[model samples]
Target: AQSVTQLDSQVPVFEEAPVELRCNYSSSVSVYLFWYVQYPNQGLQLLLKYLSGSTLVESINGFEAEFNKSQTSFHLRKPSVHISDTAEYFCAVKQSGGSYIPTFGRGTSLIVHP
Candidate 1:
């Protein structure tokens, strides 16, 4: 089974500052990585993903993450953040196969102070 670990439980950053949410995983086989964001009351939404083809992937919201197989890490980063970007971020991992189930991290709460 695969497992995900989020280094920090909370990150406090001011407006217009770059943020990086660290994520690491352990899996015996090849796996896919994903970053999901959860708003106040909404469900988890996909922020970015690293499937195959490319080692790096970016979201439409200006967040990017690179899949490093050797290091078994996929960290999410954003150049500049806004107060609206404050949310809970999660790192998920699942084996590459027909299974759609993913093991999720505890989640990192990003507080974008103004």
Candidate 2:
């Protein structure tokens, strides 16, 4: 089994400011971690994932997440945030080849202020 934790429930930042939403995970077995973004009144969209190969993964929209094995963390970072970036971000984890269903953490709400 795998457990995911999102450090902050809410994050406030001004437009174009650098921001980071932390995520940590613990599991007995190898796991896959992902970051999802949910805009208001919309479904979750894949932001970035750390499945294999490089520890770092980036999204097309300037968001990046790095998978750190030693720290057991996969923190998401954005150098410059925009107003449209305000949304709910969720961290999810699932045991590799164990279960297709993933366990998600309580989402972190990113509030981009003007």
- Write down the lDDT of every candidate, Cα atoms only: 0.95, 0.94
| Backbone Cα, N, C clashes tallied per candidate | 0, 0
**What does candidate 2's lDDT look like per residue over 60-82, in tens digits?**
99999999999999999999999
- Candidate 1 lDDT over residue span 1-114, tens digit each: 999999999999999999999999999988989999999999999998888988889999999998998899999999999999999999999999777699999999999999
TM-score of predicted structure 1: 0.97
Ten contiguous residues with the weakest lDDT in model 1: 93-102
- Once fitted onto the true fold, the runs of candidate 1 whose alpha carbons sit more than 4 angstroms away are none
Write down the RMSD of all candidates, one decimal each: 0.7, 0.9
Instruction: Output the lDDT of residue 105, model 2.
Output: 95
